[model samples]
Target: MRVQGTPDELVTILRETVVSLVRRDGPDLSARQLGVFLTVYLGPGPHTVRGLAASLNVSKPAITRGLDRLGEFDLVQRKIDPADRRSVLAQRTKRGAALLREISAAMADAATPQENATAPTNSQLARSV
Candidate 1:
């Protein structure tokens, strides 16, 4: 079922997804790092530290710090722009794509209602009789 895009519902989903991520055996990304990761993966790439800083409304140093954390997870990589020696580009990795898929699954699970939790079972019915 599709989730209603209410603010409360959205916050619940975010909370659930974050909890799932934390419970799993994976890198725990900070808010800034996650933001950088999402932007690089979700948005059109060829992304640079300067461009990310501008798009994210953060400083270049902040973007670099975020990228440094992401790089440790192998979620993102930085390479010199071939045409421009002065520029460095953030590149996507296979691991990063897999992590994105995991996040999507977590969000999907968060959005879906746990019907079994609220549904009455035959055992409960017998007990009530």
Candidate 2:
């Protein structure tokens, strides 16, 4: 079946498809939780809960709660800072890396057709470095 739509429509469809795929492959993660995970994972090395909360403009409690959830899923690990006993750092686990790979593959697959067909792909939405 041929799908006829504007570029915007296709972009939206591709975004939704990728989002759905990520959600399906990974444990049930809310948008907020996913955002938290990405922010922590992509942030500077050895991210502390307080640092993440500051970076995300959220409360420390919220960050802790989100980290707790990620911990429950075994996607993130919390370690007490050796230098500072009072500080805790959150790091992504192997499972989290694997999940990220799955999401990247799903997103790439969703964009492949339009990208190869000379149409702008969802990757275009990503800001160039």
Candidate 3:
């Protein structure tokens, strides 16, 4: 029998795919964790922990924990904010960029055929990353 639900209905499937793909090449990360990492890596300008938390719609302590994990993996670095000695900015290390590239490529690959089958091309995924 064929499944009846729309592809959008399979939230867990999508989440698992992205999580598994990321963990395959790098540290294990939840969806939220990955989102936080991406925000710091791809976000414009230097990002404070508070700013990242705000952007992610999460609490500061959550952001701090995520950053602490990323730092432990050596994927992110904490630098003294030049404008504010008491504050710090989270920067993506080269290792982090490489991992991001790998994850992006995997996500792009997983998305392309499905997207192309329904649309003219995969430009949305391309532009997203």
Which candidate tops lDDT?
Answer: 1
Cα lDDT tens digits for candidate 2, 65-111: 99999999998999999989999989989998887777667656664
Displacement of the residue 82 alpha carbon in candidate 1, Å: 1.0
lDDT of 3 by residue, 1-129 (tens): 464444543443455467657568557876667787889888795989889988988998998888888888888899999899999899989989888887767655554445334432234445877
Ranking by TM-score: 1, 2, 3
Clashes of each: 0, 0, 0
**Model 2, poorest ten-residue lDDT window?**
112-121
True lDDT of residue 16, candidate 3: 43
Clashing pairs in 1: none
Indicate whether candidate 1 or candidate 3 has the larger TM-score. 1
Model 1, range 1-129, lDDT digits (tens) per residue?
765776656776787899999999999999999999999999997999999999999999999999999999999999999989999999999999999999999999988988764534445555989
What stretches of model 3 exceed 4 Å from their correct place?
Answer: 1-25, 114-129
lDDT of candidate model 2 versus the reference? 0.78
User: In model 2, which regions exceed 4 Å deviation?
Assistant: 1-14, 17-19, 22-25, 114-129
Which candidate number has the best TM-score?
Answer: 1
State every prediction's TM-score relative to the real structure: 0.86, 0.72, 0.72
Residue range with the least summed lDDT across 10 consecutive positions in model 3: 115-124
